[model samples]
Target: MKKVLIVGGVAGGASTATRLRRLNENLEIVLLEKGQHVSFANCGLPYHISGVIENRESLLVQTPEKLKKRFNIDVRINSEVISVDSSNKKVVIRNNGEEYTETFDYLVLAPGAKPLVPPIEGIHGNNIYTLRNVTDLDKIMEKLKEKSIKDAIVIGGGFIGIEAAENLQEKGVNTTIIEAAPSILVPFDSEISNLLEVELMSNGVNLLTNNKVIKFEEKNERVVISLENGNKVEGDMVILAIGVTPDTNFLKNSGINLGERGHILVNDSLETNIKDIYALGDAILVKHFVTGQDVSIALAGPANRQGRIVADNIMKKGKTYKGSFGTSVIKVFSLTGASTGLNERSIKVLGKKYEKMYLHPNDHANYYPGATPISIKLLYEKESKKVLGAQAVGVKGADKFIDVIATVLKFRGTIEDLSELDLAYAPPYSSAKSPVNMSGFIGENIEDNLVEQIFVENLKDFDKDKNIILDVREEFEVVVGQFEHSINIPLGQLRERYNELPKDKEIWAYCAVGLRGYIAYRFLTSLGYKVKNIAGGFKSKLKI
Candidate 1:
């Protein structure tokens, strides 16, 4: 029987072992986990620390005993793979004080990732924590129990940092998030991030942007964070959620090829450079489906998929990895934020030509009492009209909208496909047309030359020039607010007052939402006038 050895036993490794056993019942599978728990919910660590998950045993998805009894797989805990000799197909395993070599015909490397602990002075001192594994969570829980952690400082404004801040605040801890970047959740567009900032701040969580944590200072049994901007923050405990890197140091001399960032290099089949060796999960570099470039994505969804693919390939099945969409979602207070495919910032980095559209629509029918507006941004290739990516942020159903867009991206669906999607809708659940469909409607119009538009970023360039900025809302709507140098001409009276608009220069049209502006754009464009509809209309202006 062929022996299959899997290193690490969380999402990637455990899933691979279980699937491998199910595929080849006679194969000898040995799973090694350096930690105590083999299969546990690592993502729920923050919640556990906040006492939301009252029972620590709730995090354990599966125990070694359960796996061994059910799948007949040998799961060894507290066992570490110190070294790998791929030439001889042997791995040096360390258990207790003894060392042994295990030879395998096929090896799967899923060592996962380690928290990036910077070389800051006093970083190793007590009260500083890095949340990566079960042990880290245990340490945090112990610390919280010992001290009244009123002030908590979280470094990094990524998903983990935001979640940690929210959970800590739920426990009545005064949480502060410090990010070196200018904004939180850099994966999101700045406008959506602005909404997140407001929400986080309103929840009593202090957000410090463009601030760097230089080092830690131990003072009076508390840790003080020293910042680059000459600001010091004292916290009862510090959580470093900066980022993570692939755990590949154990393979430095194992004749394995590593990518630029020390991630294992694997092909579409998850096969490494060495023969009969495979690498999956955060430790491997996979292709970005949109850009067709190799990138490292540390996400559980991709990791789980990679594990299944590896199992299929191991069983002589012709399963191929189609690359990752980098789809991700997170909850912050009341808002649910999610993104898929690519964003405007990523497009800029890749130097790709694309067009973007923004739409603000209720998550469900407006008549439904709890319905909230969902702000969606869609980016598509201008020439092909292909859906490249999308982002949505709102209180309810944000993830669902992003999910639809992600599915469209997977099938390489065009903007026209979005409008034609026959999605189920009802009064309490959704409108006649979903927000995703509305985005497609707007995108198709832009692609078909039916609507000429300008984005918020391009507003400054056009603002300096002499142009007729027309606000198509009602007089009362403008009474509440309007942009500078804008002429208010309600859409109801636009046809009657057609002669009032200047015909020499271009006229930029806007309304409360984008629907009215689109109507006005169609009207003015047909009338032999240079007209451009402002994407997202006045609602976008308010956000900016």
Candidate 2:
């Protein structure tokens, strides 16, 4: 039997080991983890801070003894792989203050990633913490138990940062998020992430965007963070949820190809530069599904899938991993935001000619109790009409639409494919024309030249002299808000008021949430007047 040595144990390593055993029970497998626990739910670590996941023991999904009994594989905790000797197929591991050598016929490196704690002044203070595993969660939980632990400063506004802030608020701590980027949740466009920001502010989580922490000082037993703008924030505890880096330091001199950021570069078969050596998980570079560029997605779903593919390749089954779309979702206090594939920022960087459409539709039938509007944005190639990506935000069902779009992205489907999907529908669950279908209908309108729409970002560049901003929403809706210098011509009265509008100047129309503006666009276009509907309308324009 060929001995296989696997380093690390989590979504990637743990799944690969179990699948390998199931595929071929004759192989000898050894799993090594630097940490004490194996296969723990790292994603649920933030929830435990608020007692949302009350039982701490539940996070540990597997044990060494269990894996030994089930798969007859050797499991070693507290065993850290310090270096790889690929020429001899041996690894140097440090455990219990001792080092040992392990030989393998096939070596797999799945050492995931570590929290990136930047070097800032006073960062090593006891109150500053970075959560990556159960050990990190324990340290944070201990800090939260202090009676005077009232304020927490989360240093980033990515997924982990926002999740930590929401959970910290739930634990009765006044949480503040400090983001260096212009907006939080950079994966979603500003329009979608703005909804999450609103939810966070409404729940008393302070957000500081376009700011960076220059230094950290310990003052009065609290962490004092000095910002680039000369503002100072004091918090009983600080969480450095900035990001993560690939944990491949051990393989730096191992003759295996590594990316500039230290990510293991593997072929589609997941094999490294050296023969019989493989790498997977968050520590490896993967091709992006949309752009086809090597990128670091660092998502658990893709890691788990890559593990299975790597296992099959090792078994000579020859499976290939296409790529990752970076599909992910986040829960704020009361709202959820989800996205898949590329966003506008990325598309522009690639210089791809793309079109975006937005729709604000009720998640379910309006007559159904508790129905709420969901903002959906879809991006597609202008000529091919191929669905590039999608984002959704709402009190509920945001993940559903993104999941559908992600599946479509996997198959490289088009906007028309989204509209034709036979989705299940019930009054309380979804409308007859689901939000996903609505996006497809809107896309068809754009493709057929039945409608021309402009996004909220385009308003600043519109020529005020030659363009008229028309508000087609009902008169009462203006109380919420309207564009400056925009004239009110409700969709109902657009026909009668047509003579009042200029035929030479372009009409830029808007409504509360775009449906009425779309109607106005169609009515005005038929009369041979140049018109453009404000995509997503006034609602999307608010608070941005």
Candidate 3:
């Protein structure tokens, strides 16, 4: 019988074992997990800390007893894989100070990731916590129950940090999120981040951006966090969620090839450099679908898929990993933030040729009672018009929109496909045209030369130069708000007032949304003038 020894047991390892058992019933499968629980929802940790998941047992997806009985797989908890001798096809496991060597025909390494605890002074204090495993959650939960942790300081405003802060706030704790970057959720664009920031602020959660936590100091039973800007924050507890790195310390001398970020290097077949050895989940560095670069994505979705792929390959089937778009979504207060593929920041870093468009449309029809605005941003190749990525932020259905875009990106779908998508729609659920379809409409215009556009960031460059910034909204709308250098010329009067406008200088047209600006662009372009529609229009500008 083929012996498959799996290291670690969570999303990746557990999935691999279960699938492998279904594939080859006679195979000798053994799962070794360092933690007490073999399978649990690590993503649901924040919600559990907030008391939203009142029962701790709810986090346990499957206990060792359940897994063993259901799958007939040997499951050992608290058994850490100390080292792997790939040449000998053996794994050194240490349990309760007793060591054992297990030989395997195929070895799967899913050690997962470790929280990045920066070398800040007093970081090892009792009040500081890092949430990665069940033990971490247990520690935090115990502290919350025994001590009066009325205030919390979460370092790093990524998904975990934001979620942790929100959950702590739900538990009546005054939470503060300190992000090193200029915004929370670094994966998203500035406009989405701005909206999320507003949402967090409105929820009584203090958000501090452009700030770095230098160190933590314990004074008089209070934890004081020192920021780079000479600001100090006192909190009852601190959560370190800056980021995570692959947990490959045990493989230091195990002869497994690691990538630049210390993640295990594997090929399309999920096979490591060592013979008969495989790596998956956060421990393995996989390809980024859009960028075509080996990048580490620690998301659970990709990890689960990688596990399945590894299992298929182990079954002697020709299966390969197609790479990941890094599609992800998170809920912040009332808004849901989601993104897929690359954003402007990534495109700029890669120096790739790309065009972007932002559209502010209601999640559903305006006539719908609870319709909320969804800000959608799409990035596409300027030459090919291929949809590269998209980001959406709104109260409802943001993730659904991102899901559609992610599917389109998977097939290398272009802007034209988006326009022609036969999407299901209704007044209560969606507009006559879905937001994805609207995004396609805008992308199609840019592709067909029907409109020329400039981004909000480029507005500063043209501000100094002489240009006719036309606002296509009504006078009443302009009275309520307008850009500083903008002139109110409603779309209805633009045809008659064309002669009064300067034909020599550039004309940048904008309205409430990009729809009216697109209308103005076609009109001015037909009038034989140098014109560019302000992509995303006034609403986006206001948010930015």
Candidates sorted by TM-score, best first? 2, 3, 1
**Whole-model lDDT values for every prediction:** 0.88, 0.92, 0.89
Candidate 3 local lDDT, 1-544, one digit each (tens): 9999999998999999999999888999999999898999999999998888989888899888988898989999999998888888898899998999999999999999999998888899869999998889999998888557789899989999999999999888999999999888978988878888899999999999999888889987779999999999999898999999988989988889987778899999999988788899989888999878988899999989888989999988979998998999999988899999998899999988998999988988999799899988899998888998999899898998999999999999999999998988889888998898888888887777888897666677775366878899988898777877887888999899988888888998899878998888888888888889888888787354
Extract clashing residue pairs from model 2. Answer: none
Clash-forming residue pairs, model 1? none
Cα lDDT for residue 323, model 1? 95
Give me the runs in candidate 2 sitting further than 4 Å from their true place.
462-464, 542-544
Q: Tens-digit lDDT track for model 2 on 258-301? A: 99999999988989999999999999998998889999988889
Model 3 whole-model lDDT (C-alpha atoms): 0.89
lDDT of 1 by residue, 246-320 (tens): 988889999999977799999899999987899899899999998889988899999899899999888989788
- Give the top-scoring candidate (TM-score): 2
**Ranked candidates, highest lDDT first:** 2, 3, 1
What local lDDT does model 1 show for residue 405?
88
Error of 3 at 423 (Å): 1.2
Answer with 1 or 3, whichever has the higher lDDT: 3
Candidate 2 positional error at 151, Å? 0.8
List candidate 3 segments past 4 Å from native: 463-465, 542-544
